[model samples]
Target: MKFKVVEKFTSINGEGPLAGQLVVFIRFAGCNLNCSYCDTKWANKDNVCYDFMTSNDIYKYIKSTEIRNVTLTGGEPLLQEGIIELLELLSKDRSLHVEIETNGSIPLNEFGHIENPPSFTMDYKLPCSNMEDKMDLNNFHGLSPRDTVKFVCGTMEDVQKSKLIIDTYELSDKTNVYISPVFGQIDLEKIVGFMVYNKMNGINLQIQLHKIIWDQNKRGV
Candidate 1:
């Protein structure tokens, strides 16, 4: 089976708990949701040019690299066909730490069947994203403690909603929780203050480390 791979490169883990770590990023093409601040709109367009490669081919390329941590990112990696096999192939590497970045809508049960299931970096879109209703909160219950649940907030309302989601899902206790600002908007100081005021010691405030290192709009590191 083959995948429509947008691009693959080595870059610092820009978000989540893995931020600042060097890792190989495999960004797959296509996404089901359209967020207001989506950085990779090119990935969502079906007409965009892409390299079609099989999972084995990808694994071989990664095997050649010195880095063992691989982030299977998207345009919603879950939406791509034959993705399970791709993930399965990549996970076969005992030294590799496979992380899947997904918009929380997709079902994760299929990953459970995988012998070496990848840790999920699940994003719960907030009100400002206009895709909050698309989230499947029920899916959070199935995630293991090793997975990370992130919320990208652009406004104070989004921050409020993030807190509610954590409480409702008991996310901080279940998995690693992160609340990141939307690039330019929603300054870190404001979000940090909100978190501190609310006694949210368990949750973390994160930013796009890659954007800070490179340009915010730059793709492929």
Candidate 2:
């Protein structure tokens, strides 16, 4: 299987519950949604620093570096046609723990064919993202506790919308929910206050840890 890779490098798992762990990042090219606050807009465009790589090529890089965790991030990795084959190959080596960062627009059930499913960090776009209509809540129906739902909060409206969706779907029961402030847009404390005021449960506050630890403007970790 051929995978179009935007870039690959080693970095901390900058978001979600695994914020500080070192991991190899496999950034794929292509996305189904274009959110307004998207930082990686270049990845959505037609041409980027992309290379067509096979599963062995990716594995070799990982092995060379001795990294055990691999994050399949995007431009929505699931949108790539060869993603399942890539995941299957990655799963064979039990030493590696695979994680996928997705937009949550695609149905997780569609990936049922992948024998050993990787943990998913699913982003549920809110109103502030200007892509609310694109999210499909049914996709969260069968998500396991190992999977997480991340909401990028750019504005108060986004936070409110996220709360409604979280409650409506009863997401707190099956998975961990995360409310991450849009990098550089809103104050983290303010968003945390909102979460506290609402008495929200089972939700964690997160920031882009890599941006904090390294140059914010740089790509490829």
Candidate 3:
């Protein structure tokens, strides 16, 4: 099976729990949601260049990197049909720790039936994203403790939306939850204080480490 690819390269995890860890990122092309502040629009659906390679070809690239952790990111990797086959092949290499970053709109059950499931980094879009209606709350229910739910907030409204999602689903009991301010949009200190004053529990503040280290607008990390 083959898939459309935007780019692939070695970079630090850049977000969530694994931030700062070395990783090989395979960025698939295409996404259903078009968030207002999306930084990687260049990698979105319209710009995809087909990378017609077998799963083995991708595995070979990973093997050559000498990096054991692989991040299957996107333009929403789940939008591709061959993703399951690719994950199956990657799972054979027991030494590799696979991570899948998703937008948390599509149902995880659609992809989670694979023999070996990768650790998931699911982003729950807030109201400011403009794609909030696309979210399927059922997606959050499918997460295992190995997964994390992230909220990318740009305003107090966004934070309130995130809090509502967290409380509505009782997400804290299932897995790690994180709230991150949109890079350069909201003041970090304000977000931290808001979280504190609201008594929001079981949530960690995340920052885009890659943006801090490299050009914020650059692609391929």
Candidate 4:
């Protein structure tokens, strides 16, 4: 199977609980949803960095990076058919920690059954993204404690909606939940204040560390 690889580089795992670990990032092209706050708009566009390659090619390239941690990200990585095959190949190496970052709109039951399921960072798009209507809440049941659900909020309204979902799913008790502010859109101070006022527990706030170290718009870093 051929994978539409838009960018391949190494960087720190930028969000969720695994924020500081170094990782080899394989950013695939194509997505089913368009979020207003999306930073990788270049990868979301048509004909983006059209370098089609196979899973072995990706595996070989990843080995050359000499990094043990691997992350599969995307405009929406799962939208590509080869991702499962690629993931299967990558997961064979028990030494490498494989993680798959996916928007919550897609079904995840398959991954749940894998022998060495890659740890998941599933994103539950909030109202501001405009694609929240497409989110499949049932995906939450597919998560193990090893997975995390992230809500990217750009406004107070988004945070409010996120709280309701959190309560409905008892997400804080279910697994790791994260509320990340859309960079430059929501103030970090405001997010912290919300957590403090509510005495929020079981959930944590995360920032994209790569953006902090390098220019937010810089690619392949």
- Backbone collision count in every prediction? 0, 0, 0, 0
Residue 99 lDDT, candidate 1, scale 0-100: 92
Choose 1 or 2, whichever is better by lDDT: 1
- Highest-lDDT candidate: 1
lDDT of 4 at 153: 97
lDDT of 4 by residue, 1-221 (tens): 99899989988888877789889999998899899898888898896766888999999998998999888998889889857888888878888888888999889887665678798889999989999989988898767788899999999989888888988888888788999889888888887888888888887988888899999999888
TM-score of each: 0.97, 0.95, 0.95, 0.96
Query: Over 4 Å off in model 2, which ranges?
Result: none
Can you tell me which runs of candidate 1 are displaced by over 4 Å? none
Shift of residue 159 alpha carbon in model 1, Å? 0.4
**Residue 155, candidate 2: how far off, in angstroms?**
0.4
lDDT at 130, model 4? 91
The whole-model lDDT of each prediction reads 0.88, 0.86, 0.86, 0.87
lDDT of 3 at 122: 90
Cα deviation of 105, candidate 4, in Å: 0.7
Best by TM-score: 1
Q: Could you tell me which 10 consecutive residues in candidate 4 have the lowest summed lDDT?
A: 110-119
